[model samples]
Target chain A: MSLSVAMPDRRVRATAAVVVAAVLVVLSVVFACAVGAVHIPPGDVIDGLLDRSDPVTRQIVWQIRFPRALVAALVGANLGIAGVLLQGITRNPLGDPHILGFSAGAGVAAVGLLRVAPEVPLALVPAAAFGGALASAALVYALAWRGGISPVRFALAGVAVAALFTALSTALIATSKLFTQAALAFLAGGLYQRGWEHVHQVWPYTLVGGLIALIVADSLNVLALGDDVARGLGMRVERTRALLAALAAVLTGAAVAVVGLVAFVGLVVPHIARLLVGSDQRVVLPLSALLGALLLVLSDSIARVVVAPGEIPVGIITAIVGAPVLLILIRTRT
Target chain B: MRSSARRTTAILGTAVAAFALLLTACGTDETAVPTATASAQGTATAAATQAAPVGVTVTDLMGRKVTVAKTPTKIVTTSPSALEMLYAAGGTAIARSSTAAAPGIDTSKMTDIGSAYQPNFEAILKLQPDLVVADASAQAPLAGQFEAQLKGVPVVFVGAVKYADVATSIRMLGLVTGTAEKAKTSADAIDATAKQVGDAVKGKTATKTLVVVAGRDGQLSAALNDSFIGDMVKIAGAQNIAAELKQSGQVPGYATISLETAFKDNPDVLLVIVPGNTPGPSISSIVARTFPNLNAVKNKRVHEISLDIFLQAPGPRAADGLKELTTFIQPDVKLGAAVVPGY
Candidate 1:
């Protein structure tokens, strides 16, 4: 049930995992559409998408449910891909957007700008977040680098920088009494009332960052073969590492800017993908995307429907699922 | 930021004239909530003669039997609004829930208990309050968490989600504290003012409104008619377009609404809730930039009210929110001065 590099049928397992993930994602989306504060049957949801449903029903399906589910998927996939890159480059299993301070940096800067200069167009806020994430990553990378960034050094620097940014964000939130609702949503990460506008705001980053990931993914595999071995094989280790780190930061910052900081996707999804398919970057990257998409879509659907109109934060669901799966992976991997 | 932001964000009206109303004797010492006294405490000395009883029994909003001293002089509230009501009902609080809520009181001198969600048991017990009031909307069934620590003190629950609930809570507490006449006097004043405002707006065509609490930075929670503020919205002759949305996880009467819904409704007015008197992020800008097509933003029908006049100022100044809401709905409606409970 688990995969390793030694497995003979790696390609077949990867293909099967991708297919299963894709099917689950589609099913999860349909399930999410069928259940919400306003219940629309799954068959009717499909009909509503085709414009064959009632006006109110059609609006809910198209305007609310579909956009929300898709945004969750994209955000999840973006984070998953980011996690794969970080884990590969850092060679640390715990490497992810949240642990690395990229998400925390994005949250603090974006929320700060939202409070201080809210006059800035909402669309532009993600750009600010992207900048903040890049800064934090560069800071961590610089702090960790003696001659070059080591895996242990990077992880430690990330933890310290993440703590600093998280504390800063918490302090900013405490300045006003009104941060209760919005801050709760931001802290726990949710899709409450998120719609097409959010999708529109986020997709461009996902597209560009995802393209960047695909371009450099081959380098990730070469980098995993040790720096000296990769150098002997004609790989520019540090340059590729820097490029992959930038791409990971961009992908995570974009998703977090729109949906707040949804935890566990980046840390947990890559492991599941690796367990499903042997750790080849080309297979692992795409597989991580699909697995991440499925995990979030299913968790998000459960989050919204279980409570209906009262949305439990999707982050809670993801962590609830991610934590157990993470423990299982940790226990089983050795 | 406005100069008002510096001069204490706490509204002074909540810490109103306790001594003024204290002299009045209305004999309201029955209980705080309706049917709670007789129901949950069905057997606890119910048959005892009504001649100068040492304690009055009443059921709280959580359906718990609470027996308070016939005259509780030392009172504490887990909610800022309840503390305000206690003051309005000719009673003084030995401790109050949160300092961030300035209910017309000089809160600097008062004993600060923690917030309703995380009350400081040590601070509360140190004050040795005879009667402790918690928010039914938020702190219901809370006694179980501190049953051992309460040490026989009565913790009453009061619902303050509606404008009517404000009057109801004051009357209930007044009965418990033997200040029924004063509580009645204050609650009636608010209701009378509200009725006057309602009567004025009743003639006018109702404006479709969306009451938004963006008190937390740049976040938005649509206020429904069933909400504490929404009751005032309807009473003030504004139609809560948000009221129709199904309830979400944001407390009792607030809902999560997409910008698309706002665009679809095209509400005639937008009432914005900002934190303190400090300048807040403008909703019009947020809406204009993000939801430019919204009618409220297009028509410049957005009104920003301090959180004090509306959300937190529940008890005596419930009418203040009513007046603010009515004026927000129909700008032509003239309002009399001195009716607003606090400045």
Candidate 2:
């Protein structure tokens, strides 16, 4: 837990970097709003936000696209923060939200809810998702906890559990004829007709998860050093790690609930941020948020216009971009 | 490590910021949707009638716009619907047809291109058709590739989803092939047959009917509401069970529903369409094994019809299929007189 010798200079530079990232996030949001299959001018996009003339344009901009863009940013930020926390606690560069079986757990629960209780409101999807995610995370943590949560053991257990749950989910979907198409679409992870309802549904979990990640930022910075070192430095390492795991679960669950499974953002963005702003959680966490938001928004925008009147899934674009970044990170780590 | 982290973050931030700026500049001058696009018009009409022997341009169902210098001299039709329309419009077909299972086309002089599920693309190219007409599903995936390869040749893809779309396709083919007068005459005859069937079944009580196209494995598949057979069912005044269970984005293909569910629904009439001589249990035997107590099978309301008439190809013979369906659904409706060959 020795402080880097250039602490003051590092702090100053991190602060400036964060300010720049914040500006980029704002610009990303505006950029997302301006472009879609139906082109609304930037002036009209701004005016639509301000509730000026042209009610149709205003409704399309604010009601349909704006909320979706906001949700993308929020989902991205949540995932980015969760990735940093998980990787820091596990001390594994390959640590991701999906590897922990959170998304599979959420998908299973969502499919079950749709099949058994079709009358349930769309808003309940995330709640069911979060519940399933927490239950699965707890199960994995318990099974992997022999003495301490070994990164390798935890990853192995998580992957195994994830595969099992995913198979169960697929079986359930295939069996029920009524939920087949919806289940397939959900599994594919496209944002075709998403609106304000999805945005309002997942925001609470995202906010809470993000806030908790920020509060435990310092503990994570210590935990990244190693469990014994963190504990010797007066940090409750096990408790801190557990809290971060719960926080990550909430973020991952909420995102999966809203958008099904968006792969690679969680793993790739955090590593990219860590490479840029150092391994310090304080800098890496916020930088991951900005970078994740920016990347997803750009990817979504490209997906929107790549085929006129047709859209490729955002997940496809993210994976195509994120996979190379992941390979580079693994090579660097080795 | 921190400085490296800062530099990576900086590169990502700059890249995103640059894209955002580019989007903002581009967004202002976005192209407007053209107001006068021909597709906007509901009726398929040219702005002005050109003189006789006008060069024809047709946008096929696969969204490929084909321009023919004149009416095609050598045509190869892979779709029975397209062939029926072409023959009914008096086109001189040079070579090739779909299958013996397909109704309406005179397959006596035509070479078979395998089955409807799989078309032999090489055989088709070897036919050297100046114009090729195929179903949309068969042509959609290969539309771009075919367009590139067959640059000089024209391929028209027809989607025979609705009965109205069939008529429209016939008209489009007529316009393109310089057989407008003959197309109109054939279209009128088909429309007349449909009207006669409609008049015959007008006062009959609506019967719940399940029309299934039997697959290779002897499993019954429900034809979609948007499919040609589904349209026939509706026109014949029969309530289709499969149509009732449909949801959006779900392609109406054969789904394996349990015998219990089928019996519980208890359709009054069951029409099974099976293709040429694939040995299996007859529809009656299959029904008896699956649902012995169902009213349709118990009362001998189940009937086996040729796969040709109902499910495989759609054209003038679709009217005949409707007539046959109406007769089966309502036994009192007599389709009297002679059985027409290519009606």
Candidate 3:
């Protein structure tokens, strides 16, 4: 007399992961919204969201905290997709959009633009960042290509390029006394004094980049397998890899444009998603998005609470958590 | 492998194109030669625009001859101390280097160049200043570098050590900028204000006042005897905790001290000057929180003041800062009667 257990179908498993991830994302948003310089209760946050509160509380929750929380979630999702795409194209577990010079490129360009045209509308920052990221990714790709793109060569090139761009950006900030302190905080990556204007600025890029990433999801899956195998499966391997890389670059650039160079989410989220769900792009991509949003929201919450009235940089919190996790993965792999 | 190669080539080509585009975009906005000439001409024209031919040539503390035609039509000042002195000396100049958003200056005409530490060289050049005034003690080392770039344009470096030196700086800047009478009036006002503040705090059971400046990474440096603000605190009848420590040799600032030494001193009235915002775990807050045994925190006598007033320039506003200090140390003292406006 044996009880038999049946395995869940592929669609059912994917659906379950998505549903669970969505719930976690919602919880993360709620948690992040509740913690800040002025702590709004979870009930107040909901009330504010539904427009059922008094003017003052409603302004705090809706106008201030909600935009920041939403930006964090969107940035996290963008980073997750970008990381997944980057890893998939490069076939390197350590690959991240920032490590690949995309964010550094965007940062340098954004700071340069701001310096040259201080009066330029802030809405143009994302476009400038996108252009910068695209340029950087291109540079890394070119430098690594000795005839064909080698994964190790690409990673090495990215590391070098990222260092170069970050150094240049620092130099620019140091020389100009006018924006040094402001630029320093911006480069450090925090969401202080940001509002709905910033949210609206980055949303279009995030949406477009995310949509592009989803469109190239199949191509990314094909490109994830070794070049020869992917080509053998009748996929235009080179074209697919290039498209996925471009998609990653756009997403990364847009996010960095909005919030200076935030580290770890892109690299860590995808790897975690891959571990939980198999390396299948369809499951990995969506799961990574959920996990990315959750990680950032939690990190931001910690940033708000740990310092209380004064908030620590979100980048610092992410590095503290992500660096250890990354080390464990490397140690295990080795 | 072939496909990977093609993909790599395409990516490389695209990147090269993007790099070229970025260079081109930046190159288009490069400072034009005519703009440089125009700025120079603007400085020249500023001298001609003055109402009087009030020509004055004075050797600054650093021994550089600064010639000003009718005072300064467009003066750019770095360091709040220098700005305060200039204002005290009857010079209506623009502050080009201010870190704080609220500089406490009449912002109608003053344009901030961000922070003093990182003075925007480009913005300074754009301002086309006739006279550039700054502290000789702090900014003297960079005088040659600035002079060479300005190409004969004079930079007056005013050296102020004690509160008394602030008067000397005011007189010197006044002579150079053709405001000697105004400078004397300003100097007298500052002295009177100091005396008033001093009289209020006198005989009021002196509390062991500790003057500390916050360094990078939460480090604290005690202002010793003979240091600008240290001497002022003594004049105001507060004990100098870091009197034994020698003056800072590397930079013309306070000698750095360990937290252990600071705790040992354990001053009754703690006065802290931080670089920027007075946030949590700052030098003042940290001292208050970490050492419960300290007298200042226990008695609620801890005070945090702006670096500009107390630390930066000990010129005309030194009295104002000292006045604020007296009020903080002894709240019941009636010092307001002594503060005659202008004097």
Task: Please provide, for model 3 over B121-225, each residue's C-alpha lDDT reduced to its tens digit, 9 standing for 90 to 100.
Answer: 334544667788876765654565465344434588886777777877888888877778988887777778777767767787766777877754465677877
Just chain B of model 2: what TM-score? 0.74
Q: Candidate 1, TM-score vs. the true structure?
A: 0.53
Task: Give the residue spans of candidate 3 off by over 4 A.
Answer: A1-11, A113-127, A173-179, A323-334, B1-343
What TM-score does chain B get in every candidate? 0.77, 0.74, 0.73
Q: Which candidate is the best by lDDT?
A: 1
lDDT at residue A323 of model 2 (Cα atoms): 79
Report fnat, model 3: 0.00
lDDT of 1 at A164: 95
Can you tell me the DockQ of model 2? 0.05
Chain A vs. true chain A, TM-score per model, equals 0.91, 0.90, 0.88
Interface RMSD of 2: 14.5
- lDDT by residue (tens digit), candidate 1, B1-343: 2233212111111111121122011001211221243344444445442444677677765667777755887888777677777777777777777643554665666666665655645456546778888777555434554443454467787757778777777778777888888888887887788788877887788899988776444556787778778888888888889878865433557765555675577888988776554475476567768876677778888888767646665566667667777777888999887463441
Interface RMSD (Å) of candidate 1: 28.3
Candidate 3 per-residue C-alpha lDDT over A1-334 given as tens digits, one digit per residue, 9 for 90 to 100: 1111222344456557766887787788787777664567899888866668764455456555666776787788789989998888778887899888989999888777766554465557667877999999999888988877777788889999999999988777643432244456557777654545566665665556655565556676677677888879998766676677778887887788777789999999887776655565766776777777778878877876674544677999988877777667657752
